[model samples]
Target: MNFTGVSGQLQFDLEKNLIQPAYDVLNIGGTGFRKIGYWSNSSGLSTTEPETLYGKSFNTSTRTPHLYSVIWPGETIATPRGWVFPNNGRPLRIAVPERVSYKDFVSKDKSPPGVRGYCIDIFEAAINLLPYPVPRTYMLYGDGKRNPQYTDLVGQVALNNFDAAVGDVTITTNRTRMVDFTQPYMESGLVVVVPVKQVKSNPWAFLKPFTIEMWLVTGAFFLLVGVVVWILEHRINHEFRGPPREQLMTIFWFSFSTMFFSHRENTVSTLGRLVLIIWLFVVLIINSSYTASLTSILTVQQLTSRIEGIDSLISSNDPIGVQDGSFSWKYLVNELNIAESRLVTLKTMEDYIKALQDGPKRGGVAAIVDELPYIELFMSATKCAFRTVGQEFTKSGWGFAFQRDSPLAVDLSTAILQLSENGDLQKIHNKWLRSSECSMQLNEMDADRLSLTSFWGLFLICGIACFIALAVFFCRILLQYRRFSPETVEGDVEEIELPPRSGRRSLRTASFKNLMDFVDKKEIEIKHMLKRKSSDNKQEASPSSDGKSHSPS
Candidate 1:
């Protein structure tokens, strides 16, 4: 058969003696053109070669012509040649690791082998959202008997052994150099896993938040406030004035009792009341903070790890565990400058748990350093037997791997970003990691305590208020002493005066009479002086006066 510009001529070989139509005309837009067969060259096609074609008839008035196009058997065209799905379909070969954890992605238990898992679910979901159909086949890369390194799994895609590699493979510089990676679907980082130790209850744990010095200083300030209140009120207020021993006892009792709000004594003087008010406020703040801190200490367990962080691991003589062939091994040796002699190589999550349980002294490591995903998975399985400590370091994330410059990489990355923006990625993570059988144990090593620094401002304000009250009381006492001292000195001089006498008896009697009369006159003079002084003070205080008093001095 031969075809030309939408019209073709068909002829049968005389040797075969086959009968067929001589000519057939077809239009692009006419009805009755039904597809019969398609010709696609899957291999060895060039620009100069004739393009593949489909057979159809356009004329309803004539019988459907026998349609045929040149094609080699078992050959087919690729799907969605650019961004659109081909009329037929394209087969996508995906590479996956063969380990038990990753095997779910390509399990063959289903009718024709179906893919399912954290990674596979994401990939399938992304494909469904595409503009066209993409039929895929998952090819297991490693032998089922042994686990493979993520590097080896990704290398298969780099070598074009498969179209793309998808799993928990993390994106790293070395891997990126050989293959392109989509945006990370899972956040990843390194963490330290340590064996859980029993936290013994301390009898005095309530006092752990504040140091001994802080307690002692706090007690001293309480006594000091009490003494200040006593000094301001001792002479005038009966509640404070007493025998030296009784007063000393009262001061200590009131000061310490304020801590518990149990003081029964009341302040009668204004200055004393002011000092008590400031002291009460200070006590209120201190007591409140102490109660909060002590409550936290009692209710929450104090978790302590033998090794606190990566730096601690590096500085100590104790051995540490690093997964063999992992990036962490290189990180410890090169980046952290840790000696290989102090390093113990671990291979799997089981190894990590075993090594930590055995301890550093017994042929095991003090801590295990591995990726956070693995640590989380381990904790999920072991429950409270292990916990992750320290900050996540050497940050990286897990992503799908593809051949360098592969066209699929861009589309896959865009799909992943869209999935993340729409919250589908988070839902997948919750299904896999959050809903897993293993629950994460809480770590309390980082819980904070209330310290003196948190309430020092309250104490400072109280101290200033107390000082002002003390100053006002002292000034009032000094002014009263100056007003009364001169009158007492004048009375002493009047008592020493007496008139001359002849006989001792008459002289004594006359002197006594004169003394009585002089005492009466002096008493009258003192009364007049007191009244005049009081009236003068009132005149001076009156607002109507300009600069002088209206009454005589």
Candidate 2:
């Protein structure tokens, strides 16, 4: 993302079917796929667009009409771990066990550490579907952190060939005849590039002729406006002819000046000037009519205040930006094959955030990041600093990559399944997304929402107080009856007939009668001994449970 200000991460452009092999009929890249994507249908009947469990498109920000969307693959019950055969091009993701995250705290980076990203979400899901310990450090290239060198310096040598096995081998159609795949723990692309141009501290350092697209569009607009004025002058002045017509001269100047930055135009033969004037007026009028249309194409139009999308950032090639060596970069590189010299590599998302605040042109990395929403914020806080390129390039599944054939994947997946079955998956979602202090603040935004001050514990406390008071009141009434009419009925003949409601009742009655007079009679007398301490402003004090002397009011 090229968005500026906020240091965001993980705002990836997610498109369905961007996977390496694309999508086959057997795969999910086709029309059947949906993502942070949407689906809708309309005909003579009606239209529908349902909300998925993520609440994506179900709210006011996204006016998606109601439609039926599936629950998350890992969250759903009755799912097959790996192979149930995809239907309607949807893969069934069944994890073995569900694991909720620690929702109480956010890391210093503002992103959750220990637990993070598509990997965390999909890893938990994959654990339920696959056996674990899937894989160890396969191989490493580039430096592990963003220091003097961001990539693993010695390349594969850094990892000691833990990832040496399958570098380049093509597959024909042989099952048992050759090397095999353990199981695809994850399916996605890989990339990390260098920006082609040097990033300037100030984002707007270069704009003379303006961008190529802007120059063309602006010139055309001016020419069209001149043409319109020329037509109007001609319409009314057809009956007279003169070397100096105010309207015609004004139109000429406006259209001509739009050609370049020079304020004075002195080089032109009489015939050339005439030709230039007529042409300028003609073009200006034509361009004027299409201003709205031209406005849409110019890059500057879209990026007036801040950078708009990912492409501008890449094309700008500021040295400041970097992304992980994930498939997104690979698409921008080897596959998309952006200029190699332009690409810069960073080890993690952390580096991307740190460099975003430099002067616009300083680092030359106008924009850098994988996550989209996070970037939106990152750029916003930076005074609308960067921009984005366009739509998502590819869509792929993210899961915990494991050692080729590890059973631990199965165990983890089982744990995920168990959690999901018992509603733990949802609990985790609510916990992380809703329990934040941010949520508490948001709740206070209106009278209808719950706030931190209105926490449920407060209500529970009130209820307990009421219950205790009621219990005391009832006990008092029971004791009063024993004292007021002890034996008025002791001689009643009817008591003889009922046998005093014996059995358990008789035992209860006897206990109540014996306790009628039994009570804690010791008086806790309070003698007000006001003592003024040296503090001048006296505050009430009392003896604490530990017998510490406390000052009084």
Top TM-score model: 1
Question: Per-residue alpha-carbon lDDT of model 2 for 1-553, expressed as tens digits?
Answer: 3233343222324664221111111213324554333332211111322212323323444453433333433334343445332333332221111111111211112343233332244344443445212232222222323222212221222233222122111111221122222223233322222222222244432232134454465455455545443432332233211344754565667556644423243322232234445444444543443352323222231222133344555556445344443333444565555765665554433455445444245553544535333343333443333444445444432222223343443455566566557776566545433321211111111222222343234334433433454455447545543443333222222343345546568656755654433221111110111112212223333224324544453
Off by over 4 Å in 2: 1-320, 324-329, 346-360, 369-389, 407-553
lDDT by candidate, in order shown? 0.66, 0.35
Query: Can you write out model 1's per-residue Cα lDDT over 79-161, one digit (the tens) per residue?
Result: 34355433355667788766644233233335444555778788877776655565678877666655567787777787878
Q: After superposition on all CA atoms, what RMSD does each candidate show versus the true structure?
A: 12.2, 46.3
Candidate 1: regions farther than 4 A off: 1-91, 100-116, 143-146, 195-198, 435-460, 486-553
For model 2, what is the alpha-carbon lDDT of residue 135? 30
What TM-score number comes out for model 2? 0.28
Q: Ten residues in a row with the worst lDDT in model 1? A: 42-51
Clashing pairs in 1: 33-57, 80-86, 380-438
